[model samples]
Target: MGRYQCHLLCRWFFTQSLCSVIVQQRKTIDYSAKQNLLSYATESSLDHLGYMTDTPRLEAQSALTTFEFRLSTVLTGAYTIPAGTQITTGNNVIFQTDVLTEIPPGSLSGTVSGHALVPGVSGNGFLPGQINALITPLPYVASVSNLTESNSGADQEDDDNYAERIQLSPEKLSTAGPEDSYKYWTRTANQNIKDVNVYTPAAGTVEIRCLLKNGDIPSDELLEQIGNVLSATNIRPFTDHVIPKKPDKVDYDISIKYWISTDDKSRATLIQSEVNKALEEYKLWQRSVMGRDINPDEIISRFKNAGAKRLEITSPVFTVISEIQAARERNIECTYEGLEDG
Candidate 1:
């Protein structure tokens, strides 16, 4: 299937409506627990009927992916970096892609990825991808070689005032698994969303990270709002399915438990509708992995540490721009590198 599936990963996600869920399936070919469907977690069914998928998902890159865009100011010498690290303006070739000195400043080029593959990179657009250090004799083109290339005459044009807009991709767990094109999504659920693994009686568990948003909502109304989200979305309503069987005291299936948060800012970080759906679609985990349960207070504490002060879970298209701009404003020294499949 294509990277995007018809499975409604997200419905109507707007302001503070962003969310990402990591789901692992639980093993349900039990001999006994299939007989007791009592607790929301304990397995009572004989087969893995209600569960979505099985297999813990790792990203296309690392568990934690970081993408940065850097731009430096040059007063005299020329500067040429990766193609994808710059911003852009209207019909103008604002940025220069050369390695000369004294950049008059117009635009810097930037790049993002389509998948594990980086598109046609003759080095015109943002050509950064997840590649490693060291190449056999690095070479830079001192002059143009293509006749079809425009601006063959603007070699000395000023380029300081304009910014080149580039797309940037990050390293991820996608390096594993087939068709594993996935990015880290933030959750924007309510205090009710949590890691229910603690509720389980066993160790083989599913790592669940639900992101939510509570930046603008009032303290008194947060839980209620979260409740609305849960009820609105039927099957994916932050719930767990149970199946049962043999010798175990009380077997837990795939469903996790809980609600975690402490304050408004921290509480703003919860899971959203689509993220939960993505976890189901990706089927990242095996059916045997169980979900952990957590309370509101604990979830809030963790988000604060992640540098999320004012949180909202909506679809932030400019998320990449923020990183690019931050690097530009602060004048950090970073190469225009991006994500690669290897």
Candidate 2:
């Protein structure tokens, strides 16, 4: 059952006027007609003979959870270690060499880099000088020092993310071979890809830039997979050459001042909390899609609606960039400039 069909069903079960009102005010209704419609259409229905439609699963993205550490050795002889040699942390988390390295003849130590063999977000978010213990004890290997910082591990996708992707399926299916096609294909590869910008620089060349939801760089493996999928004959025209790349990230700094009538510390705190929440929501809305300009008016409206007595935006005087670029909010700073006299 689609929305129209659900509406008809609703009308048949209830009064036509009531069903129309429910459909119109679905946004506020606890049991939204749109949601009910999706449930009926995707799930089993008496008219459809109880066959459930397939839904897209939420994708899990791997974070670079481990960092490369320099290995210092006291052994006074040339030694060659093959690529993929395992090095273990004190907690037994495994790391593998990214490339083969050879200690020069008569050299005491050489530099080598490794990454976590296991994917997904886990382990203590270790910083430099944190991982000192090695699982495999070797006399030649004297000490290990992390040269770079390790990112905290991430978990699998949640239900809310899964539903959001499923909602985009209808629009994706409607697109033919335009920019929307590239966006749809990229999203199919990974749901964490929040924004995709497509540019046709030449007659035969298409560039697709993607931005991750978590604001981190996409891994090389993920980029390769996207390239492979887009290169398929059925997915893209043979005459067109596709380039998959990451977008240039631009961060926005926001400062807000709002007035409130109350002088009570707790009441002021509550208003500040609401304003902060609204700003966070605005950031999400701004980055929800690609090629969206940063509208300062929207921010002002959001603050005013958050019970601000008088609102002034000191930063982001105007829209940041055109729709061609992908922009993300790096941080937001809000201040309540004392109570208002009104």
Candidate 3:
């Protein structure tokens, strides 16, 4: 059965809205004078029916499967470091150098880079200067640092994400044109990919832009993997040229003012906290994918939802941009003026 129909059946059979009628009937029985066998039977039947209806729904839910996204880190060190040498951040996250960086014959050190040995959203999201040191020492390596921010660490895909992909699977599975095939392969390459856009500039030239889960650009390794997958004979058109690129990033600068009730002096702090949280959530929502327009009204609505009696959004004059450009919220600056008279 379809998931939606199964849910409907489960709700109809197990919900209190359905059982309440039987409960009302039981209450009307004149059990004050004598035992009501019919009422007891009705209650028992209701309980059994609820169990029967909910079991299949729960089983179907349990049977559903999901894919997980791989996590990665980028570690950099001096030259002449051997591959497979382990380094770590202070938090116990370990990484190994991928290639050996050899200096000239007499030189003391060289430079190399590596990634996290394990995957999953753990260590830290792409925070600069986060990876500090090595877990152990290597002979030729002098010092280590993060070349680029570590990112793309994600947990297993949740139900909503999985369902959305499942709905699109039919289109992807078809033997459509190169554009369709490009999208199919790119998305399947990494679960952390938030969205993919395909453009055909010429007869056999294809441009694929990818947006990652955290709104950051995809790493070189990720792009390489995507290129490999799309270049496969079965996945790509033999005559087409595929070029993968990252979306252009656009940062937003927002300033706002909120009017708070003067009667509650302590509310000033709460109001500021709420406004800050709302802005953070707005950034996440806005940057989650590419091609989203920046709307000042949406920002104002967030403040209203956060309990601001009155708000004025001062910046971001609502501009329309292309899908290839992604809006980002970095170093958000917010001003919480004093509380206003209610």
- Least accurate 10 contiguous residues by lDDT in model 3: 56-65
List the candidates ranked by TM-score, beginning with the highest.
Answer: 3, 2, 1
**Who wins the TM-score comparison?**
3
- Give the TM-score comparing model 3 with the true structure, all chains together: 0.64
Candidate 3: residue 197 lDDT (0-100):
85
TM-scores, each model vs. reference: 0.17, 0.62, 0.64
Tens digits of lDDT, candidate 3, 1-342: 999999999888788676888887776665432322313323333334324433110111100011111112223532344566666667777766666555555444344556666655663353544554666565444455665566554555443344334444445544445465567568766667768888777888888888876576787657766788888877676777888887888877877767776775676787778878988888888887788999999988998888677877767769775777788775556776777786
Q: Local distance difference test, per candidate?
A: 0.22, 0.63, 0.62
Stretches of candidate 2 off by over 4 Å are: 1-61, 65-84, 97-119, 123-154, 163-178, 214-225, 228-238, 262-266, 329-333
Displacement of residue 135 (Cα, Å) in model 2 is 4.4
For model 1, the local distance difference test gives 0.22
